[model samples]
Target: MQITRAQRSAVAERITQLERSFYGRGPSNVKVSVSQDVPVSLVVLSIDSLTAADSVLSARGHREAVIRHHEALHDVTRADFINAVEDVVGSQVHAYLAQVHPDTGHAVRVFIFADSGDSRELDSLDDRDD
Candidate 1:
């Protein structure tokens, strides 16, 4: 089923609320988009202005620290995020990927939904060398 704009907005709002409740702060902006692919559907959440500490740490030449902090926090709160997304999308998320940019203090969270049809097979690396 195709995701609707209202559903996307609802997902984004839920994510924002989760961030605020879990992290004590929410991003300055949040965007949610859906992409339908061959084997699965992807719901992507992009966030801007992660945190004030990100800028401070990056300015002190501890950019990696900022990234690591976000990653660790995300890991700890993974289940909460996954649950919120699943609730809004009304589908089980098979995989979740998250990343943060040290310089820009931007982050992206991708929720991969299960496929409802046969998946396309990919060629092996050896086949590509032929």
Candidate 2:
């Protein structure tokens, strides 16, 4: 099934709401888009003005720390997010990806619903020996 613009907007609103509910405030703005290819559907959100001073510090000299921190924040909210999204799109989210650019005060989140065989759960996994 294809995701409609209204549904995408609703998803974006829910994300903003959840951010507020979980973190006490939402970003300055959020934009959401949805796309699909074969076994998985992708929901992407572009967030603005989301860089916390602490997160930026973590980003500057400790890239891994920042990524983990970003993941942890998303992990805490994943249940509500995945449930709401699955309900909206009528699919299960097999994996989720979240990223932040603290220097730019921007963030991106990618929700993958279903296991598309070609995809990588983590880019590092590509280097593992078969």
What's each prediction's TM-score? 0.81, 0.70
Supply the global lDDT for candidate 1. 0.74
The prediction achieving the highest TM-score against the true structure is 1
Quickly count the clashes in candidate 1.
Answer: 0
Across 1-130, the per-residue lDDT of candidate 1 in tens digits comes to: 5777888888888888888887778888888877866435555555565677778899889989988998898877877887887787787676678888988767788877766542211223226559
Candidate 1 lDDT at 68 equals 91
| Cα-lDDT of candidate 2 | 0.67
Alpha-carbon RMSD, each predicted model: 7.5, 5.9
Alpha carbon lDDT of each predicted model: 0.74, 0.67
Q: Candidate 1: how large is its RMSD? A: 7.5
Q: Write the per-residue lDDT of candidate 2 for residues 1-130, one digit (tens) a residue.
A: 5778888887888778777777667777888766667555665555553546445666667656666666788766666777777777776666777777755546777777665444433343335534
**Top candidate, metric lDDT:** 1
